[model samples]
Target: MLRTGASRLALRSIAGPAARPAAPSFTPPLQWTSRLSSMASRRPQLPPMRQLTPIQGAVLRRAMVGKIDRKAEDRYQHEKLEPHPELVTTTSSVRSAFSEVATPEAPKDVDMMARVKYDFTTIKDTFDLSAVPRQAYLIGLAGVLPYLATSISTVYCAWEINHSVAGYGYFLSAQTAEQLLHFLEPLQVGYGAVILSFLGAIHWGLEFAGYGGNHGYKRYAIGVVAPAVAWPTILMPVEYALITQFMAFTVLYYVDTRAATRGWTPSWYGIYRFVLTFIVGASIVLSLVGRGEVADHIKGIPGAVDRMKNLKDDAQQALSHQEEGIGAQKAADAAKED
Candidate 1:
């Protein structure tokens, strides 16, 4: 029993040393700690925003504008804007050129045709109106001059009519001549109106002719001369008889001339004279050769001829009536004496 007790005491002492923990093992978990630290260090960080200073912001804004890129500031800048866009100003050459070509108030001709009659303040509107009398006079003269041939024809016709008829018929012929003369007044007025209108058209046309340059100027000059030369040559016969024809030709000539002076294109042949001459000649021939039937409703020469014949017939009839009355009275006296 003594031995067994001693053994127990030894075992107990050994067991007592084992009862306390060894204060954790001597080494730590190095791999796990290192891995955690590395993970934390490797995580991405955000970049801080860069805010602009107020002064810098204002400078950038100003740089975007055109106010600082002025023409005087840089010739290069000015050239860049030319084909693109630039503000129109009084000094702009392009604008000035456009205005010169477009403005009506600006005169283009060397002589300035609008100034031909001095002092537009008093004359322009009345110029046409005042010209009426002159037109009337010219038309009347034209109509009257052609009547010479008609007058001879009329006297011959009248003498024949009187021989065939008597006194009252002669009186009728005289009255007809007076009536026809009265009708001529309106014809004169009509011719005057045409001339006045033509003059006005030509005046305005010349004002626009300057855009054609030197070649255009030459073209215009020739165009104006063409009509002027043509109408007068063509209307020679008409001017001698029908004032209306003269007036029409004159007006057309004036318009063509005016347009030509203004740098307008001329028609083919450059002359209307042949046209007028042909028209007048044809009309005169028709009246003189076609009998009084052709004279009927025909203006100018034909009408004039008809009027002359009527007048002659009236005079002859009156003379015939007087002769008849004298012969009858003498016959009655002789019969009473027998």
Candidate 2:
């Protein structure tokens, strides 16, 4: 009986939930199966294949070769169209480019000449002188204003010259000084007169150019004034005189003479044509006749600029002589000291 009971107990124990190999550990297998199912569902996908045929590759390669050959031929046709070294860079071409890069660029003379031509054209466009549209009173005032001022200034300058000459003549105790003074006084008077008259002429010329709507005249005027303003501060000793005369002549040449030569119509030439004609004709006449009569003829002429160049030349020569004399005196003094 006991054996029978023991065998039954042993059988029950082996079949029990805790003693039957724990149902062969089924949770692990189930967990593994679930994990495998999830991994299969999450797998990556691949793209479809692009099947390029052998014939297609051959065609593409041939096209590329044809393009490169065409490009080479084009480069040959244009001398400057050298092959790109990286793309088709030739050793000689690279060396040439490098050498050129090292060399300095040539000066642009053509550009400078073109600029001068443009400036010349601009200067020729401004010239007009008519006061008819202005009130008669204003016109008369403008005309007489400069003249009155000029005359007054001239008379004052002449009086000063005469006084100086008379004083020198008295001091000299002879009439020789008076005779020399007479000639010299007139020369001084002539210079002042010319300077004043030129002031008016220059003013009139510029006014005409401005009214005539010539942009070139404006540039010429600007050039004239520029010199006048620059000389006051510039370091050069000759700048004062040279700049003044340059300003005057430059304005006259570019604004008045050039425009006149171009056949521009004036509202009124007035006596200007006859005046200029006479002055020019007289200069020729004096030059041809004799030096003794030159002064006599110049007294009758209207324009002042015709004689200015000669006067400036004379003044510059005098200045040079004075400087030379000073230098010689200094040298003589140094020798005496030695």
Candidate 3:
């Protein structure tokens, strides 16, 4: 029994505080402490942030903070802008800006005498007569025959009338001359108007040929109006009508010359027109001179006046002889009665 008791005491001492209950205190439980220690070991730490110094803060402010103030300083500088060299204020520079650099000189008047001489000298060289077709020349020459014949007949008629009146002492009673002249004068006027209208038709033809547009129509209109102007003048007296025809020819010549100058017609056309118009105008003037009243006025000049005075003296002598014969007959009858 003593031995068993001693063994029990030794076992108790060895087993020590395990047989007693644990007191609750601030100490964590073993499972919780173990979990916390494991989490602390796994977690990552962050680095510390650094603070800026005063000098660095000042530099940042200067570089970025006051840009508006710096721009204001740049805008209002003291120096003036340089002017362009061409815009300098010298007299020559100012004059060059205002004055024209390449103005042409005014045209001088042409010397008419020199022009005439030049034309005469260069006629054959300048004019290529062969360039005109043979048919054109022949037709143009044939057209002049009417004017020539009419003019010649007029002058002959005038000469015959003057001879009859002055030599035979009375006007010619023949109606043939007057009738022919009356017929021819209107014929000439009508023919002239027809020719003028025909010239206008040439413009219309040109318009249709290629120049068809507003300008061509305008040319045609001018031609039409020219003929209308000629038609009304036909009703005037023969002399006045001839004068109008002359004026009309002059106007046509001017217009055609301008047209030729403008390259609307062949170069030689102006010369041909001038020649034809001259002949026509001369014929008209001759016809005018052949009128009876105009011829009488021409014959009233010095030589014709002397011839008329001699005829008057001869008539007076014949009348005096007739009266002397009548008186002698009367005196002889009276003597027979006594």
Give residue 297's error in model 3 in angstroms: 8.9
lDDT of residue 128 for candidate 1: 32
Q: How many backbone overlaps does candidate 2 show?
A: 5
Indicate which candidate wins on TM-score: 3
Candidate whose lDDT is highest: 3
Q: Residue 220 error for model 1, in Å?
A: 22
TM-score of each prediction? 0.22, 0.22, 0.47
Tens digits of per-residue lDDT for model 1, 1-338: 12244333333333222234466665548987787777658532211212334543344344434445466677875565333233333334334554533333333334445356556745554333333345544563464444333434444443433333432344455345434433533343334334334434443454465433444444445435434544443333323434444445555555554544555533311133223334444433433343343233334443444566878999999999999999999999999999
Candidate 3, residues 11-87, lDDT tens digits: the string is: 33332222335667787899989889886685322111123234433333344333356556776675567645543
**Alpha-carbon shift of residue 186 in model 2 (angstroms):** 5.4
Count backbone overlaps in model 1.
9
Worst 10 residues of 1 by lDDT: 43-52
For candidate 1, give the lDDT of residue 61. Answer: 43
Each candidate's number of clashing pairs is: 9, 5, 0
